[model samples]
Target: MDERRESPGQADGAGRHREGEALPAPPRPPRGEELGGGGFAAEGQYFLKYDHSSYQQFRSWAPAVLFWAAVLCSIRFPAAAAAERSGEESAPPRVRVVIAPTLSYGPLWIALEEGFFRDEGLDVELLTMRRTAEALPSLAAGEVEVLGSHILPSHMNVIARGGRVRIVADKGHHDPDGCTSEAIVAAPSVIASGRLDDPARFEGLRVATDKGMSGYFYIDTLLATLGVSAEVLRTFDLPLSSKEAGFTNGAIDFSTAAEPWLTRLVRSGTAVKWKAVEDFVPGFQSGVILYGPALLDEDQGTGTRFLAGYLRGIRRYNEGKTDRNVEIIAEATELDPELVREACWISMRDDGEIDVESLVGYQRWALREGLIDRAVAPEEFWDPSFVRGANEILRSREAR
Candidate 1:
């Protein structure tokens, strides 16, 4: 028999250390020291002295006592360990997400419909808050846990003030080779009269825009590249639903449109896609994922799990706009199925990577445009580690 292997019964006086090595005797107390019946320490080891009768009783019963204790421990602890491993010990967390009514939220819908978030042990609730100004304060207050919305100067202002909301992942960006995801369209007359061809003729044109929003950032950036100052154009702060009407009545000569709205304007002959955003600002980081205080808590992994689920959804979205993708988008946005199918979908980074430099550049522009009091470093507003953790989680799942 191997000296290290002990019989489970231990009825033959086999109590020993786990390594099966005999313990060296502890150093003796000083000569004639009056050791009492109480436990005492000798050198670094503890000793429990017993009288002759106590020693006999202890020796006979110790083995059976330890044997039964081990059996009970084996039975009790594995059940608790297994419960923890299966995540049944704790209740699932509910994560509330805010999004706009647009195709950009397609990935979020995909994640929800596919049970990706649920797979991460999260229960997700989505709320729609289209306006950036309204959404920023709500996120800062932790009323919502996640936000998929525009990169706004107002949001930067909150971060500058020490807000805990974080920009975690990329939601949408202008793709150089993809369809018209974002572009500045013009009234048919504006394009027909050759105004679109002459950059200088952009002056004094009525533009449908909300100068308070980051739509100004994209417009200003593109106009700057063209040597046309945005100041020369008249601007209108109109809701997205009202922009089509503005174009229909010739109330707006220029405006920026995204996705199905872009396709709708062109289909109605209300506007012509005169300039693709990539021609001026390639890979513009127009949309981002934000996390509120609940998700940003350092001690919890909720943020990482939420993003991991979202990245899974993004991978599914990147598989091209198939019938399923169109169906999800049409139902989510309440757009016609044919229109959702016909519209050019915006491109997203499959790995949930955000263009940090583009975000930095946006803040500088915001500063110059007086939209924010100061420019913020990428670290102040962005948290890339969630994406890193999310990728690690996905990689581990794949490896498994």
Candidate 2:
């Protein structure tokens, strides 16, 4: 039989360290030889003999000591270790958004300015585009995650063609109270012609609007409501940037206007507000918050957080047309504060629920007019999960 020898640092069967293996370091002797009676001296100070056994013992246990040190560090600062493993701490993911510089985007502006997005662990960047048409390509390409604009026939047509886009939330709408941002404005010449109030006289008049835009549908609806055949009215295609000039030069008889343009037109004596669009179509959805595939499919969590922040901002906006909001709107639009204060505020739903009936009605009208190839079902066009989740989160916080 072979005999095994115990290691030097191993404890005995009685749980005692091996002989001379666990000796405590000798206490320091007094500084003087009379006090310590040391045999060696260095630089006029007596010195004790060097201990090789202690050095050997320290070397034997060094690995375990270092290992325990690391374990203790991890226990104390686990988050720091996890962060280092994942790389430098990162800021919240950014959600790029495109919006028109209109008062209808008040909620978006409020959300951005109030740091609501940040609070929800999202960074929002707002890109200003003059028209929704101008932003559609970017939205489709995933360059932008969200867009605030009127729900146009073009949007429906895109969906009908399998475009990965959908309306997620309400932006603005016309209300029964007749408080609307959009109005039908007539030029000074048309107003002076005494035909502004006469619906019958509206026939054959030149109405300017961007083709395939919500304004086009609005004009047709207005003409139909006035008992005038839309076929008889001359539809002039004009960009919004040029509409003011067109009205001033008397190049257009009528056009859809929104503040602060409406206020500017009336104040400039170039045009007069003939009627608010709400007077004809109450509870019409004039604008919506659209989401693209990137947000809905790839990063839905960020989208959900974004909606939570947006709903919070909407609540703040619905606090009524206060002076602070007017100032905020003025600063955002770069318009005069007084003009912003006097401009009509766009109506929005406080609960973030969209008017599904209004959206369906508009879609049917567009289909009938051949503006879209086919009607998109509500499920295919509207996604309520984000809003529902956001509301749940908000409600829980309120309860807390």
How well does each candidate superpose onto the true structure, as a TM-score? 0.76, 0.76
Clashing pairs in 1: none
Residue pairs with backbone overlap in model 2 = none
Per residue, candidate 2 scores C-alpha lDDT tens digits across 18-120 of: 2233345223223222222112211122223225643454456546556544554455367656768899675466676776667787887777777777678
Question: Against the correct fold, how does model 1 do in TM-score?
Answer: 0.76
Off by over 4 Å in 2: 1-88, 196-200
- lDDT of each residue in 1-400, candidate 1, tens digit only: 0011011111211111122224343223321113222222211222334466545544565565565456555665687678799978544666767666678888988787777887888767655433434556667877667778878887788888889888899999877877778788889988889986788788898987887776677788888877999999998788676788898888989888887788888998888887888777778788899987878874349899999999999999889778888887677667888888888778899889988888788777778778898998888888898999999999999998
Worst 10 residues of 1 by lDDT: 1-10
Number of clashes recorded per candidate:
0, 0
Q: How large is the C-alpha RMSD of every model relative to the true structure?
A: 23.7, 26.5
Error of 1 at 96 (Å): 0.4
